[model samples]
Target: MTLSAEYEKLEASINKSISEHNPRLDSFLFNGGTLLALAVTIAATVPWPDNVSWLPRVLAGLGAFLIGAERALNFGERWRYHRRLRDAYQSILDRFTLAVEASGVQRDELLAKITADLDQIRRSQGDIPNGTPLQG
Candidate 1:
C-alpha cells in the first residue's frame, strides 16, 4: 500500500479507539450522576413507613454502592487515558501528513512511533472493568 494509504488506516484506527472509549466514559459519568441525584431526591422527599425504618437506609446504601461501583469501574481514568491517546495519535498523524507532504515520510519510524505511543498509553491506563475491550 502507498504511504498515504497506510497512514490513513492508522488514523482510522485511532479514531475508532477514541470513539469507543468516549461513549463508555460518558455512560459511566452520566449514570453515576443520575443515580446519585435520584437517590438524594428519594432520600429527601420520600416518606417511608415507620415500621420498616430501614427503607431509607437501604436506599442510601444502594446509592453509595452504585457510586462506588462506578468508581471501581475507573471509567473516569479510562476516559482521560483515551483522550490523551487520541490527542497523541492526532499529533502523530499531523506530523506524518506533513512529512509525507514534504516527501520525507519514513514509514518504519512512523509505524514504530505509533505502536510505541499506543503501548505506552495502554500501559498507563488504570484498571478498567472486565469484559470491556481495551481498544476500539
Candidate 2:
C-alpha cells in the first residue's frame, strides 16, 4: 500500500479512538451532574419523613460514588489524553497532506518526520484508562 493510503487508515483509526471515548466521558459527567442536582433538589424541596429520611443522603452518596469512580477510572484523564493524541496526529496528518499536494516537496523526509512525531505522541500518551497503545 502507498504511504498516503497508510496515513488515511491511521487517521481513521485515530478518529475512531477519539470518538470511542466521547460517550464514556459524557456519560460520566452527565450522570454525576444529574445525581448531584437531584440530591440538592431533594434536600432543598422535599421534607424528610420519619421512615424514609435517606433519600437525599442516598442521592448524595451516589453522586460521591460517581466522583470516586471517576478518580479511580480516570475517565476525564483518558478523554483528555485521546484528545491530545488526536490533535497531535491531526497536525502531522495535515502536514503530510499538504506535502502530498505540493510540488517539489521532500515527501520522504516529511514522512520520516511524521513518523517520528507519531512515535513521540504515542510515547507521551501518559496513563489513561484502557491503555491507548496506538497502532499506526
Candidate 3:
C-alpha cells in the first residue's frame, strides 16, 4: 500500500472505530430501555405458573435477544462497510500516492492481517509499515 492509502485507511479506521465503539453508551441505554419495556409488557400480558416468577426470566430472555440481535446486525453491516472502505483506500493509494515500503511484511500478508484482525492498529504510535493483524 502507498502512503496515501495508509493515510486513508488510518483516517477511515479512526472514523469507524469512533462511530461504532463510541456509541456503546447510547446504544446500551436504548437497548436496555427497549428490553426492559418489552419484558414489562410480556410480564403484563403473559401470566406464568403460580409457583414461578416469570417476569425475571422474561426480562433476561428479552434483554439477551435484543442485545444479541443488535450486535449481530451491526457486525454484518460494519464488516461490509469496512471491506469497501479498505479496498477504496488501497486503490486510492495505488493510483495517487508514492508506494509506501512496508518494512515488516508482504503486502498480501498485511492486507490479510487488516481484513481479518486489526485491533492492534489501535495501540501503534508510529506509522505502521505493515498492516499485520495484531494479537491483543
Best by TM-score: 2
Give the per-residue lDDT of model 2 (tens digit) for 103-125.
44577677678788877866675
Which ranges in model 1 have alpha carbons more than 4 Å from their true place? 23-27, 30-52, 105-136
Q: Mind sharing the TM-score for model 2?
A: 0.62
lDDT of each: 0.64, 0.66, 0.51
Clashing pairs in 1: none
In model 2, how large is the Cα lDDT of residue 116? 89
Each prediction's total of clashing residue pairs, residues at least 3 apart in sequence or on different chains, is: 0, 0, 0
Model 1 vs. true fold: TM: 0.58
TM-score of each: 0.58, 0.62, 0.26
- 19 in model 1: Cα distance from truth in Å? 2.9
Give every collision pair in model 3. Answer: none
What is candidate 1's local distance difference test score? 0.64
Candidate ranking (lDDT, best to worst): 2, 1, 3
Q: lDDT: which is higher, 1 or 2? A: 2
lDDT of 3: 0.51
Candidate 1: deviation at residue 11, Å?
2.6
Segments of candidate 2 deviating more than 4 angstroms: 1-47, 103-108, 124-126, 129-136
For model 3, residues 1-136, the per-residue Cα lDDT tens digits are 8656666776675556545434344445555656665766566566677777776676667767765655645533444444444454444334322323454456556555554434443443222222244565
